[model samples]
Target chain A: MAVTLKEVAERAGVSRSAVSRTYTDGASVSPKTRKKVEKAAKELGYSPNALASSLTTGRTKLIGLISNNFHNPLFLEVFDLFTRRLQEKGLRPLLVNLTDETDPENSLRMLKQYSVDGVIVASSTLSPEFAKAFHDAKIPVVHSFGRFASAPDVHVVGVDNVECGRMAARTLLARGYKHIGFLGGPKGATSTIDRRAGFMEVMGQAKGIKVKESNAAAYSFEAGRTAMLKELKGTHAEAYFCGDDVMSIGALSAINSSGLSAPTDIGIIGLNDMEMAKWENIDLTTIRQPIKQIVDSSVELVMAALEDSNRHPEARLFSCQVIERGTLRPL
Target chain B: MAVTLKEVAERAGVSRSAVSRTYTDGASVSPKTRKKVEKAAKELGYSPNALASSLTTGRTKLIGLISNNFHNPLFLEVFDLFTRRLQEKGLRPLLVNLTDETDPENSLRMLKQYSVDGVIVASSTLSPEFAKAFHDAKIPVVHSFGRFASAPDVHVVGVDNVECGRMAARTLLARGYKHIGFLGGPKGATSTIDRRAGFMEVMGQAKGIKVKESNAAAYSFEAGRTAMLKELKGTHAEAYFCGDDVMSIGALSAINSSGLSAPTDIGIIGLNDMEMAKWENIDLTTIRQPIKQIVDSSVELVMAALEDSNRHPEARLFSCQVIERGTLRPL
Candidate 1:
């Protein structure tokens, strides 16, 4: 059985209020009384209940970490960074997996029931409406890796997908590829939409350049491989710019299975320089998304929001850069 | 502002007890009063606080999921299955990252403060003493992927690493490998010790067979690759049984960097046929650990412990088998 505060008070021969004051932060209590209470508590193995004390402090220090993509290997890095950083700040993460969930009502209900001090939606595929739900309910929220907006309804921290798309297009053009393809993730996803728009914007302006575009069912390996297999059946493009690194790996596998290889028969470039992209056998040349900076900025924004709920929602965008590897031909 | 039960009751023209009963499971409330309370709560956007109600129910429905290895990709699959399964049971997972932590007292104190109903230590590197700490403090715990004991002090759910090692030795011998090597994880980890013991037990009895053994600093890719790079400087064995798949992938990368390949220049087999092992580029033949079954059984055991805290601890060992792919030479 857990040791109760009352038992510690009895053991210390002090009133319950004195024992409470001894534990509460910055609460006034004489050093002698504190030493006595501390000795008794240690002897009794008594730890104050955070939930009971939360009733008075009105702060639970719990953050709801909401995400939808578990299949993507990139999320492993994201979770590791988020959990470790939150733990350092003395905040516990209540993980909520919304893999197949579309509605926000169930998650909101659960978050409120737990009385989470704030929420962080760490997904690029989830719509802006999802994070807005928490804000509408007066819950402090920050959306990490969310779509970039000039004036976001909630605090947003991530890269500009449209600019990333433009960068991918310019890189391919510089490599002297006449015909290229865009193998993107889900068509309706904001990341895919913005990336496609920017790719088309640049490709359309370039003289005598032909571009074909297709999308995978989801941002997963099987989906990317399946989509690439269908593309390879016909006369495919010389090289392609894949949606993300995981999809690029999948496409590389499909090429290998079809008795072809990268940069020799088909060149590919991907975004999101996840850990897997750096492996020797899977040497994928890709654009790097600064995940650590994004996560840290999101946490800081949420902490600021908790201090002042009326703080205006701000958008923070980090720049993306090309990480040169062997998947694409040398420039 | 959060809508209180008193405001909800006043709006519904009912008593505070009626509003509380309407939300509490199995509580007494008339249908008319329940309808009125629901309408008022919906109008006021009120959700009952689980933490506050936990005082009366004495159940938080929160389970602490503790882990240490975040660099391993296999953990992505493990966390995905665990969070989804726990959510299905209406239990929320409070993720605790113990990446660099050694002492269990800190975790025990934090877990006690939140009053989590139970804990599941899902790590092979963590010692049995870690889980026993929770058991000694009267907190129900189940150690998934933990080392097995004949009469375990806490509920244990995982595969038998020793049998897996023996199976690896037999499989390599069947392939007519005369010189074999054992590349194990950290020396002090229970899983590593047990697996090495079993592998040695089988190899020691074979005649005219040479076995060389070494251990990596960690199970991560960098450690595996660095260890293998050093091993390649000498006359390495024809085949190696790596501790796990991540290490196997690392070893493969190392082999490639040293201008070698698998099944031709060198052969390798690994444990935990993780998702990446099946990719066409990395068709690693490995022993499958039945991760989904292990996770399901661990959740069930913890739920049972929740119902009866005094229940006797049991060990559930699942068998593992080799999943043939392209890494090992055909037998």
Candidate 2:
């Protein structure tokens, strides 16, 4: 027993077309008629069905937000920001979890069936080809936290992981850590590859500094702990730069379990200063990625592409900075 | 640049209706024709648009997955499971973030506009009325992590928070903690209220066991830390049963910052054994709320409701158990 638009139109003493126009965005309707239609609609508890009207406008106002890394705590912030920004724009976020998905063809087919107006692929681990597949399927797509390219094939928004790597390496060296190591996330992730490259680039130039590198199976606490435990078995470095905050916390747990404390026996730094990084017990000194800005820009880019499918693809990069906390040793 | 249905039909030497029926679920078509249509569609890169087909079927197959607590790590798992399950059913999840939302009218209106087949309210903090509103609007609704009722207004699936509270209190008493405290979530949340009721109920029965009660503004690390810091200014309890694991971790941080340690200087037990609770560095003893069971049941209820909107609403409840970890003192 839902109220119908016809009843609302009859109650408002307006034509059905007028009532439809009043509710349709960018449709022509007088202010007085719009007010009358809105009042009647509210009184009758009538909500215009977006799906029914999408046939006329050919826009569903639904954006597919695809991601694969739910285990990473950093995604909590990413999902929050993406949903909020999309809601602000009156667009609904259709969350697509690719946790076990590898083939872009299946994802592309599924998203196509949903007829999502655009897509925001929010994952660092997902390859660029994933976003490219959506674009090739005639869907507007933006890859948030995707790799940067000199000439991008799709709309990309994220930080320079390579620069972040070099920065982490230099930060450790400047802190007088002669023996340093890079504790990275999964070896397959582009983020891990780029960050590792930058770390080695800077470490290779330094003299009298020994560097070691290894990767966690995933960007998770358990993986970090497992990888760090193996490193501790051998000659551990004076300091280490973990790939991300979750991994850093995991590595920290491994250190504490071995009766060693941070900044005293060993120092550690992480990336993506997630909320957990500031917790007093896990006060990890880390690099802060502009998550909110990146998400907002990704939404904006997708919306723009939706309006004009022919728009050239571009990369929007944000800067990352170090957040000083309890994990890093004093100079 | 997209292949049309007519092109695929022509290539397969079949009628366009046959091609369309081939894409529609459960639509009748000959097997030989289906094979030919599928082969041609694959070669022509033809994908049927879900939005366009919704005009005929009146089903978008989009379910609204609404949540309010993005900061709580438990939601990460909830979202992951919900999305994966929905995808398996060929249903899309439209994520509705009610983190900043206070008005039910606005949220209900937004969901209606999308014409979602159903709505799943996956939050313990949101009021029951939120789900009722959707049901009242004739939208199939399921409440996950919601309070259990003997007669539910809508489909309800989760653990009995009151029983969990009692479980925590008994665990603490068993560990010889005489001076105990209840660190709850927001004051208005049903989970917090029920948990407090059960905790106080158990403590009231036991003599000579002093119990203090306080609430964090939300089930978040910062809120938990802030509340604990305030409590620490005065005489603190021998142990605390936090409303959730994230808050427990926050309280643990506050205790550590005050030169105190858990299980020795102070004891802490949390509810919802989130992934972080098991982290070695934050080995939080917590009550494990069966998140997977709750989510799976919620999905089942919502899907059932969708198939038969007239189905009687029911409440499904799961039991909670204490997971022994490092946060609480030994017996």
Candidate 3:
């Protein structure tokens, strides 16, 4: 049987209330009683039950980490960073994988059932409605790697996809590629739409620079390869800014399979600059989104919300820069 | 204000117990009352509180999914499968990232505080002590991708690493590779030790087959690359059986960087035919560990343990087979 708080209190020669206060954060208790309670608890191998204590404090310290794109390897980094940072702050991450989920109701129900103190919707493809649903439920939520909006109803932390698209376009133009294309992620994704907007806006300014935009079914290597293969069969661009690193790697594979090579037959740039992009074999030139910073800030925001649910929603945008490698041609 | 169960009961024109029974799984409730309760719940946007019910049922429905290696791309697939399967069973996944964690006590304390129904230690590199700690704490646990023994102290679901190593050796020998090597992960890892043992056992039987063994710091691309670079500086083997796919890919990169190529200068094979192994760019010949099966079985085992804490600890070993790809020379 698990050791109880009563046993620790009795062993420490202190009141049950003192034992509870010692375990409760910011709860006042005499130092002598606290030291005795701690020693007794340690000896009895007793861990304060978060559930039992939550009934009193109204805080579970459980954060719902919701995501949809598990197939993408980039999320591995995101998950790692989020979990580590949350763990450091003594907050537990309850991961909710929304792989086939289209309705946000299911996720909202699950989070509510789990009694999560807050939630971090870590996905770019998921519609803003998903985040708004959590807000409507009055749950503290922060969207990580979410689309940038002039006015966000919920906490938003990520890079500007539009600016990333503009950077990709400018990088391709400087490389002297008159014909360029935007191979993006899912067509309906806000990130893809915003990126395409920025890319087209820049290309339209430069006369004689014809740009075509297309999208992969998903942000995966297979989808990227298939989309690039289809593009190769038709009018191919001299340079292409693939949606993300995974897609860029896929595009490179498709080009190689067709007896064509990057930077010679075609130039490519990617976003996110995932760890795999830096592999000597891949060496992809891409836009580096500050993934670590975004994750840290998101965790911080969620913690702040936990402390004050009335905390006003804020949008924290991190700047992304070009990371030159081997995928794109030299300017 | 959030809608209360009391309000839902009053609106449904049914007793509070009747309304509670309607929401409770397997609880007895009349059809007419159930319909009325459901209607009232929908109208009030009332979702059952899992925590409040958990206090009565003594089941939190939260399973701690623990992992140490987020750097390995293979984990993306593992996490995806585990989370999907857990959610399908109406269980919540509390992800415990032990990337930098060395002490099992910390994890045990955290899981205890969370009051998780069970835990799934999904790692090959983490020591047996990690899973044993959970078991000792009276928590139901299934170690997925863990080392299997005839008499396991804790429930284990994974492939036999030793047999996999023997298969790799036989494969390399059949392909007429005289000098072979074992490029494994960390020396302290159970997978690495077991795989090396099997590889040496098979190599011992074959005459005129020279074998050397080395290990990477960890099962990461950078570690593998660094290990292989050191090997290339000296007399390397004609072929190598890497610890895993990521390591194999790293070795391939190192060989290419040194102006050497696989199947010509050297051949390579790896274990865990992860999604990336099939990428046209990597195309690694590897041993498929049946990750989906292991993850599914792990979830099943943990769920069963939750139902019956007295369930006997058993080892569920799955078969691994060689996935022929472009890494190895055609026989």
Candidate 4:
């Protein structure tokens, strides 16, 4: 039903190989022949079939952009950056929502079936095992927002969550919050474990400072609210450094409902500094994770891997900065 | 190198056709033959490639899930639903981000290049012409969260924005907001036009009630806040029916920053009761747009269109319901 390359070549009076070379990246073709082919292609409104050409080139140009936490507002930024970056490089994102998907074999098989050139598993909550599985299957995979690994098994791009944890703890302690709480995402996620580790590491040394810890079932608004509500049921800390902004917002809501105001009754701090954190209604004090840098680096690494799949796996970590807002008392 | 189907077939002691049929949906194959094929496939780590079969079947099972609004939190829910629903049907979502993309030809050519089975235009802000262009190109297209049309150029699955506007107006008036305003999304968007028309239609008849209109640049937090801040610079109405929740949240932020409270100072209502609207912190009073149903219906329509490309375009409109929360002044 659609115009074929053969027809375009015939109309252009050029060889079929000339037409193919005209559209193929880095393929050599005479300028005169390219002009003729382009005119004919435009006249016939023919687009080079990427899937058909992928069979010959053995490259689909499809990146399986896998993510599990679609509910997080931060994903709005993450996906936007990832897609735009991927597209700028002439690559398309095949969004794989592994939300509630545990088995890596099925997802690996599915992505392989689609013949995606590479996979970018972009989630902190999702286990590193998924990345390892894809890598073992011989698919080029980059884990964005993945936990920092000393001896990395896969290409990882994200902030040093442990350092961000320490930053949050210091930000609270400096503000004179004697009793602090670490309200984190799911206890199972490496992000939660690392952040908790850093928070405990800092608080463990502070003299006369008491610390408490609680975790949400998932990195969701409802989960954060439920965990905070449970904590508020008995004794609550003077300040709580929520793992991320969404959870911090949830904790703020619980505090609001409890007839108390932030920075006065119970100070709050969050990480990620998502767009919502800046909303006037929820002016949350938070830490800024360089999402753009992480996504950009991830894309660059994947492109490099596409060229050299045997590239050594490395961890690309960024630093976090505290974004003070109305959630905390002035130091 | 990936394992080929021939290798699996040879190992299973079955014809290649039998192996292909075992993987193909609704294909005839004996249970014993299927068992042998499955075992060989497992042992050889062979997965049927969608692109390879698409050459013969002419179906890629790849749906182009196109969206332009990645900044809005509401899209988190929309994307989650669309990806999950598409996956449930054994179809993969080829996510196309049209952010900053205005030319339909480029996107059309790209989707065609990938040989997607169908396209779902999932943005109300994007022009209906995009959907129409894809349809003209003979691609099955369904526009979700799009404008309603008695004679739609393409299949549209969303709510009646006109009715939703009237609901907001009536809700605000019932609460005794004598002077109301319409803080809509981009003026060019069909949602903004229909919503404003409905609001004006009801307000035009209300005796002794004054009404005004304003528009945000986009349905985003910053845009809404900026538009509302501009609105507050002059003589503003007693209440506003913001076109969507993100904009309403922006308006709420502006109102709060001005030291005015909702209901007492000004009443505000929003559409698309997104997850953030229900957050304990935001607790926005909004009209539910039933995003899940719209997405589900849109996927079903696209799948049906794949089966029968000649299917006539239809408009599937869902009713909106106002969710009572802390944003608005109670009657």
Candidate 5:
């Protein structure tokens, strides 16, 4: 049987309430009584139950961290940063996978059942509707790597995808790539749509530059490869701005297999400079999303919401910059 | 204020106990009362609080999913499969990152405080002492991807690292590579030690089969690249069996940068045919550690342990197979 507070109290020659107070943070207890309780607890190897204590304070300090795209390597960094940051602030992360979930109600129900202090939805593909649903149910929510709107309905944190798209167009044009293509992620995703719009906006005004566009089924390597392979079999552009690094890597593979060299024959640029993008064999020129800043701000916003449920929702957008690597040709 | 059982009881015109019985699984309740409670709950959008109900059932249905390595791409697939499987069985994953942790006592105390139903340590490099610590504290735990002892102190589920090492050595020999090498992970890691032991045993019995051994600082790509770069600066073996796929990719990059090619200048075979290993760009010939089966079995074992805390610890070992790819020479 596990050691209880009552047993520790008896061993310490103090009241059970005194033992509880000693373990509780911010609870008043005499220094001598705390010393006695600590010694007894150490001897008994006793750990105060967070669950039992939560019942008294009505605060479990559990934060539901929901994500759908574990396929992207970028999320591994996000998970590492998130778990460490949450734990640093004395909160436990209850990870929820939404890969197969389409209905926001199911996630709302799940988080509600757990009585989470707040939630942080970490996904670019999952609609902002999911985050708004949680907020509607009176749960403090922060959406990280989510699309930013002029007037966000929920607390959103991520890069400005449309501006990144414009930046990609400007970079390729400045390099004197006359014919360009936009190889984007799935058509229905908000990021894909916004990026396509911004790319079209810049290309439309340039009379001499010709632009073409298509999309992969998903943001995965295989999908990008399959889409690019089909393009290679037809009329392909001289330069392309792929959706993300993984897709850019896949497109590079297709080009290499087709006996074409990067930058020399067909230049490429991607977004989200994930860890693999820096690998020597797959060095990619891409936009850095500033993941650490976004995640840190998301955590702070969620904590603030937990304190004041009525806190107004805010949009936290980080700037993206082009990271120079091997894939893009010199200006 | 959150809706309570009392509100549901009042709306349904039934006793509070009746409303609880209607919500509880396998609890006895009249069909009329159940219908009434369901209507009232749906109208209020009330979810039976899992934490509050856990107090009475003595089951939080929370499993502590612990890991230390998030940089490896293989973990993305692992996390996807683990979280989806756990959720399907009505268990929530409380993700605990032990990246900076060296002491098992801290982890033990943290999990104990949460009153989690079980814990799963998902790392091959972590010491067996960590798993045993949870077992000693009378918590149900399954060490996924952990080294298997002949007589396990705790439930272990993964491939036999030693056998995989032997298999790698034999594969290299069959390919007619007379000069072989073992490039293993950190020296002190149980997996690395076991792999090295088996590789040496196999090489020792083979006549005229020269073998060299070196250790990488970690299971990551950089460590493998650094170890191989140092070897490339001098005389190196004709073929090497890398401890894992990420290391093999690193080694391949090192060879490429040195103006050499895999399977031509130096053959390399790695373990754990992670998704990246199958990519056209990487195309690494490695031993496929059945991660899916190992993960499924680990979940089943942990669930069984939760049902019966006294369940004896057992080792579940899956077989590893050589996956033919571009990295190794043809037989």
Candidate 6:
């Protein structure tokens, strides 16, 4: 048995409307009456059901947080920040794991059933259309760690992967490595494609520089290791920019197994300076994607859209910088 | 504007009761009427609101998935398995990140507000009373990776940390390590306490075997490294069974920085056999805690409790085994 608002009102000696107003957000209630209602509610162990109140307010305060990559350690930080920030804003995250399913229609339908106030597609690998599906369904949506565009169909918050790639290339070249390589993530992923373009763009213009490029099956350690093993078999470059931090760790493992060490026999750099990248053992030099800022900005945009659904869509991109460690050779 | 069930009923030329029955689980509706309602609903773009229907059924199909340690990588796998498994069962995971908060009262109040159908407390470090709070509030709960109790206050699913500790001690003894140590997690965690008891029990019985014991601040890499670095300052044990894999990797890092290496100047073993433990760069010897099986069983127990709220509390413990790798010396 649970306590009801009417029972709390009776115990507090207040009208039902007063009790309801005390619980509703942004509703006016006098201090004396609100204190009485809160005391009675606490005594009766009554918590207004969010779902029941949502029927009246049409705001469930539930945000559909969708992500496709769970294997990447970076996402753990992503999830931590998103959940905490959303919680701080009095919103709950309905975590939707898209690791297996790819169709946006199914997710949109599920979110619609729950009547979530908005959706945050928190994945770089997921296409922009995935976030658009929510928008088309009349749901406020923001894509975190998504691709940047001058004009966007939905609110986008993330880093410039293309610039990150160019920066990685330039970092390697500045280290005086005549032959450099790019080890990207999955071939079809937008992040991989964009980063590869930037890497090629910089390396192609360099004089007397030899460059090689390849992609791993996924942005995973095993995939990077597997791809690197193949590269080692056929004259690998002097150094490589291996996708994200996880993949770079995998590539470093492959190099170590091949009787080679970073900055001695070969050099490696990664993106997304995740926590593991700075491990005393891994000590991976990486491009730091401002994950906290991206997640916070995404939450802000979604909250704004919730207040006014007609807000124009925009892309907010944060810059990345090289976090020098042990993996890269000194310039 | 969103479509409504009444519109779908009107479009299908069926009674409103027929449309509602078609969507309600286990509600009887004729095959022809169900087909008509489904087709009309699809055409009208009507998705039955779960929160609205909860008013009638009193079930929201939302599960509060709570955890305290997001920094530990093992939890990434835990979250992935829990989210996917909960989704397969048509339940949405309301992820509660308690990385900062520790008060069970706050979480209990929050979950009650959401009216979650059930709760899953997935953490070894969290106190047992945390799960008990949910049970006290008449919320069905299952604690994954929790300490084992023959008479659990709630459904508990995980390994016996004490036995795991014994196994780790025996494994080290078999490797001919004379001086051994137990570097546990936080001193207050039940996992750390039970694991220490088991480790001391075995080591205490072995005559002429020296045993040293300490604890990391938390089950994290930095804590492990810091604790191990402190140990290395004095006459360190010949080998150590760190709290978990992440800590073991940290201890290894400390040893490397100290100009010592595993299985040569020292030995190390860990628990949880997390993904990173098997990385080629790490190759940490560890005890395997079957994470998938634990998560699946926890879900099952919580679901079963949802169906029969009067069900008696039960504890399901899985056995853990040593996964031999490069960290420990050979037998």
Provide the clashing-pair count of each candidate structure. Answer: 0, 0, 0, 0, 0, 0
* 2 against 6, candidate with superior TM-score: 6
TM-score, candidate 4, first chain: 0.98
TM-score of 5: 0.98
For model 5, residues B176-249, the per-residue Cα lDDT tens digits are 99999999998989999999988898999999988888999999999999999988987899999997999999
- Compute DockQ for each candidate against the true complex: 0.85, 0.84, 0.84, 0.85, 0.83, 0.91
What value does the lDDT take at residue B238 in candidate 5?
97
Q: Is candidate 1 or candidate 2 better by DockQ?
A: 1
lDDT of 1 by residue, A127-188 (tens): 99999999999999999999999999999999999999999999999999999999999888
- The true-versus-predicted C-alpha distance at residue B90 of model 6, in Å, is 1.2
Chain A TM-score, each candidate: 0.98, 0.96, 0.97, 0.98, 0.97, 0.97
My TM-score estimates for the predictions, one after another, are 0.98, 0.97, 0.98, 0.97, 0.98, 0.98
Q: Residue A221 of candidate 2: its Cα lDDT?
A: 92
True contacts kept of each: 0.87, 0.96, 0.82, 0.89, 0.79, 0.88
What tens digits encode model 4's per-residue C-alpha lDDT throughout B173-235?
A: 898888888988999999899988888899898999988888999999899999888988999
Clashing pairs in 1: none
Per-residue lDDT for B104-174 in model 6, tens only?
88888889988999999999999999999999999999998998999999899999999998999999999
lDDT of 3 by residue, B212-294 (tens): 98999999999899999999999999999998999999999999999998878999999999999999988899999999999
- Local distance difference test, candidate 4: 0.91
Greater-DockQ candidate between 1 and 5: 1
List where candidate 2 sits over 4 angstroms from the true fold: A1-15, A30-36, B1-7, B10-13
Interface RMSD, candidates in the order listed: 0.9, 1.1, 0.9, 0.9, 0.9, 0.6
